[model samples]
Target: MAELVLVTGGSGYVAGWCIAELLNRGYDVRTTVRGPGKEESLTQAVSTVADPAGRLTFAVADLLADDGWDAAVKGVDRVLHVASPLGITAGDPAAMIAAARDGTLRVLRAATAAGVKRVVMTSAANTASPSSYATEGTTDETLWTDPDDPTLIPYRRSKTLAERAAWDFMSGHEGPTELTTVLPGAVFGPILSTGTIGSVGIIGRMISGSMPGVPRIGLEIVDVRDIADIHLRAMTAPAAAGERFLATGEFTWMREMAHFLRDGLGPHGHKVSTRQIPDFAVRLTARFRDPSLREITPSLGRRNRHSTDKASRMLGWHPRPAKQTVLNCAQSLIAHGAV
Candidate 1:
């Protein structure tokens, strides 16, 4: 019998790709959805890459509530805890932190009780970043972001806290289940569906001419497919237990990404503008017109870069070029009519 793997939040952008990759690798996969209605969309999206056939199944579970988690993990050998609350617009930071931190514990508790062999959780590269991104240097998994830093955004704080909580939980845990985490940078790649693009939305916005000019922000690009690959590697690798791996790929500025879209996609990338927006203009708009812009304003002149040497050496993981990822992202959005 094939090993059964449980993936939380089956309908997510990254989770959808994870399911496809697992199914492609001949694993019998079961995924958690908030409701039954989400199964169809997840199936449709994953079907684009691999045939789910009899290998794919769905379980109803939610991060916010304790219900259905045990059944969701029942009979599974391994777990991929990919589900977590995320948003760009800062609302109540406390609520996001609670959902991420408490929700992760909920999954860990269930998996430990079920005696699952391993659980690979998805964290963010920002979680390993310094309190200030202005510091120019290469950082590895050894660095931990201070969650209590007041300058930290809600999303960053939530991810950092959640990962920390997971480590803390496993520290005192006397269980058979092992835990590993894969931290990814800005995830961009082919979209299986137009449903929820997540961070890939930045590419869609650029292609749609949503912004008059590009912000001075920079991004460490990682393909969604590569992110999925790292997750699977973490789940099975012998050296991955109780370790965290940074999965960042090539670092590219928003301007470079815009230029790639414009030159690579031709007609499809017609709307992409490489014009750099003045930092002052962005600050002014963020101050009054849009609060979401505030989240990225801090990254205006970002100099920090994350190292993937740990993943490369331990798991033989490698990501594609930033230009290719950006071009592919734009092409996918065009095919889906999302731009």
Candidate 2:
């Protein structure tokens, strides 16, 4: 009998790939959805990569509520807690924090009670970054961002707090279930469905020419497939327990990414603009045009990058080139008619 792995939030961009990769590896997979209606979309998405057949199943669960978590964790050998509230600008920052921090605890409590062998949680790279990204250096998992820093964005604070809460919960836990975390940066790659692109939506917008010009921002690109691979490695690696691994690839600026899309996609890439938007123009636009732009204004000239040497050394993980990842991402968006 194959070991059953439970993936929280099955209908997510990263979670969908995790499920497909697990099914391809011959693991019987079960995933949590907020409602029964979402099951069809998840099933359709996962089926695109691997034949779910009878190996894939779904459970109703929500991070904001604790109703179906117990049942979701029951009988699972391992868990990948990939579900969390994410937004650049939230109407209520505290609510986002509560959902991320409190919701993580809910999953941990259930996993510990069920005696699951291991739980690999998905965390963002921002959780391990400094408050100011102006410093030009490579940081590792050893550095922990201060979530209480008022300068931190809501999403960054939520992710940092949630990961911190998970570690704190395990510190006092006497259970046999082990915990590990995989922190990924700017997840990009093929989209399983057009419904749930998550942060990869930025690439979609770029490919569709939604933005007039590129901002002076950069991202440490990591493929969605690579992120899924790291999650599975963390779940099974003995050295991964009670450890956090940063999964990041080459850092590329928005201008470079725009150029990549424009040169790589041929006719389809014609819409992608390689022109850089002035930082002052972006700041001025944020003042009245869009409130969400305010959140990213701080990162207009980000210079820092993350070191994934820990993930490479410990788990023997290696990510594909950033150009390949970016080109594939744009191609995927085009194929899916999402652009």
Candidate 3:
């Protein structure tokens, strides 16, 4: 068999698309799930987009430990390190940070040891900018959150630490391995399986009246497919080495998505709402309740836009409009009975 492109966390919500795209693009891929028994969900997800060419394979792996990772990359040609913990629910903050940073380094260490040529890591805009959780305006590659800052969100801090550590290891020292990072912001798009989609949970709450009022924060909502595309391009483009490409769309208001949920799905969909709480009102509500709301206040009335000139000029990468990405996700969610 030909060598496969190894994708960590292949069973993930977003990485699954990248796995399929790799399969479609004629690269045999080996993806890792947390355990051996969990292959069913991963296979079902990849099958949704795979062409039945039998090009995808699964390797059991975990982010918090190093039991089987070294062997997983033994014969792989390249590695797509897309497996990282996301969303803050419950767990040791220090452990999460350790797993993200150490676990990523673990794979790179294995890839380098195995003589793998290139590695594409899935990073986030949060790592690129500290104010990412803030509710307004545009943030790009220029921003980097202070790891020592107490105000940073746990999940965001972990991503920043993990990515910076990886880059430091690969570039700061000479090695046979090369690195490329894809920094995506609030990615949402087509579903590869029948499950809860990315961050669109906030959108559903808005239209269902679950969220009595929309918060004033803004997001640079890029589609998952676009994010997946960026990963693929980074893997093949020789110029992508040692670069962190910001993959995001124009700024979008929180409630504006309700219109997308209602009007955009048009002709065959649900239309729940187009109403919103004013920025001042949200600020007031945020004041009495949570400090997280303070983070939401900055972008209440602005758009966080970015230029794709670099990714475009160099790798021919282009993202569909944010509106279209939202529409596709909304439709996928409804079709899958998630909405």
Question: TM-scores for all candidates?
Answer: 0.98, 0.98, 0.89
Write one digit per residue (lDDT tens) for candidate 2, span 87-126. Answer: 4225788899999999899999999999999999999999
What are the RMSDs of all candidates, in order? 1.3, 1.3, 2.8
Evaluation by lDDT, superior candidate among 1 and 2: 1
- Tens-place lDDT per residue, model 1, 1-339, is 999999998888999999999999999999998888887788888998999999999999888899999999999999999997874224878889999999999999999999999999999999999998678899999999998888898999999999999999999999899999999999999999999687788788888888789988888999999999999999999999999999999989889998998899978778888999999999999999997889888889887999999999999999999999988888898889888
Off by over 4 Å in 2: 87-90
Q: How accurate locally is residue 246 in candidate 2, as Cα lDDT from 0 to 100?
A: 96
| Model 2 error, position 191 (Å) | 0.4
Higher-scoring candidate on lDDT, 2 or 3: 2
The better-scoring model by TM-score among 2 and 3 is 2
The clash count for each model shown is 0, 0, 6
Which candidate order results from sorting by TM-score in descending order?
A: 1, 2, 3
Per residue, candidate 3 scores C-alpha lDDT tens digits across 59-159 of 77788778788878978999999987763224567877888899999898889988898999998877766454443444556677678777676777899
lDDT of each: 0.92, 0.91, 0.77
Q: After superposition, how far is residue 166 of candidate 3 from its true place, in Å?
A: 0.4
